[model samples]
Target: MNQKQSISYVISSQSSSQQKNYRTKLTAVLNCTRLLLMQELSSRGHDESKESLNKENLIELLNWYVARRKKINEVLFSNAPRNDQMTSPSIHKDLVHCCAVETTRSMINEMGDSLFSILVNESRDNSIKEQMTVVLRFVDKSGHVKERLLGIFHIADTCAQSLKDAIDAMFPTHGLSIFGLRGQGYDEVSNMSGYHSEILERLNIEELSGRTGQF
Candidate 1:
């Protein structure tokens, strides 16, 4: 059988007696923990620790879960180098991040060397550190308006220079060139895009320099 068919057969052949394997139990525990974490994060609007959850009777139930869930993360992480192996709900989360990055890169590539604009924004967590995200607005190869989400970035500070550096680091790695960028959309932060902001002006100048070098 092919690899996919082999997996299907293995799954279809699982009898009740074979369901008690450590790997099987580990999978169930991981699924339960994931569901609980999602519910907790949704209800609390942030990440919660086992310590914070220990006050509840549910903690006892989850502790039983923990007993069975041991070593799964280590096994999971050892499986591969993709972001999924390092993250819970690994396959799904990695696919989401990958889609966001790939869709944006594809849109930019279809822009056909025209002037386009990018928007940047930041979201903050409980620790109050800002994480930046970028979006590109462009027309795709089929002449349809498409907006694609770029990847989230780490903003070490709210300063303009830091934002520019982050952009610099992200641009080349995605096969994106800033040569034809015509405008920038930023939040109402004065330091980011104000008239006298050296960082913002420097980005525009960088785009111009890239354009000049293309000719």
Candidate 2:
């Protein structure tokens, strides 16, 4: 039977609660997958906006997929009622947060006790607030080098000390330690490069003191 006929049959055969449950699960999966894809694209320098991934667009994409693939249509739409879609904005936000957490966890796991270097840079946003962005570079278990965007932090100022302090405060939250940092890099702009040298000196002093039991 065609997809529409199959869906009609399933709707008639399935109970309302069953249809709702199927749709809820399917929506959650599709939303999480889409959010992850969008994040990957964004990281690769693709510009994306919420309107591009809005609920209506997602629903249309799902419908198109169902129309093309017999197996996917049978599995996803078989018990899902046409009107029982779950596309709340709040749910989408929650899914996006979940994807972020999962991606960080996976990155950390792949890092696996390896020493990583950090590349740091600062920029002001549209609001004129300075923010520092850090990216971690390391070799995974398979011996391939990888770089992941660790985080972006709002800073009180872009001074060397303030930037160093911000990174010091951030590492522990993710179970990372300055001791694991083998190297650091910063933007080649004169002020930023100065910050890089000062921060490296500070980190070296701290590492020495920690090992030697001296303040």
Candidate 3:
């Protein structure tokens, strides 16, 4: 399905379940509305009205709905966990992240190779050790834009040959092809940019000899 239809389906599925409790139903509605609002806001870029889509307004709506829904639940179950300690955990961040990841995967699937580029970069996160991030930029057959984070690959070593081997494995696993690769981008790394022969050089030699490139 197209993006619009897909987003609608995602929202609809959450609220269409008949087995959900009233509180759960309201929560699903709030989650779906937030996702829809965020999608619209993002598509409009910086031009969207902040006043209308303010986070506070969204939170207030959700809170109001939850309160009303809780009252209804209480009438249905006079003695069913009325204590404050029985409150369900808030899952806003986790739910939003899950939706975002799924949306990205869908976009990538729609973008069936219109020439792409690979960018590899390593950075230290909270653990203070290097981790490699692999990103792909491409366009879909329908001329739609798409960008995907393949994943953060752990750097076993900063060696170029090792990185290249990891990349080769990733590409095949993802059903992506080096044939669609228009360019390879990297900042100067000690091993990849070293004087000693790297993966690029090895591949070049093989290409020159009309043989298949090896990682």
Identify the leading candidate in terms of TM-score. Answer: 2
Could you estimate the TM-score for every candidate?
0.50, 0.61, 0.51
Show the lowest summed lDDT stretch of 10 residues, model 1: 41-50
Residue 57's C-alpha lDDT in candidate 3? 37
Model 3: per-residue Cα lDDT over 1-215, one tens digit each: 47656956655665533324545544544464565557563211232233555434334344455576764344232324343212223444455556656755675687665667777887778987667888887777767656677788776766677677777777776777666666656776656543464666643433432332222
Against the reference, the lDDT scores of all candidates come to 0.59, 0.67, 0.57
Better of 1 and 2 by TM-score: 2
Please give, for residues 1-215, the per-residue lDDT of candidate 2 as tens digits. 47656867777887886765676566545654575468553211132243554434444555566677664565454444445434345545566667777878888888989988888899999999999998999998889999999878999988877876887787887888766767667767555555435555654545554543422
Pairs that clash in candidate 1: none
RMSD, candidate 3, Å: 11.4
Clashes of each: 0, 0, 0
lDDT of 1 at 189: 72
Model 2 alpha-carbon drift over 4 Å, by segment: 1-56, 63-85, 126-128, 189-197, 201-205, 209-215
Ranking by lDDT: 2, 1, 3
Clashing pairs in 3: none
Specify the highest-lDDT model's number: 2
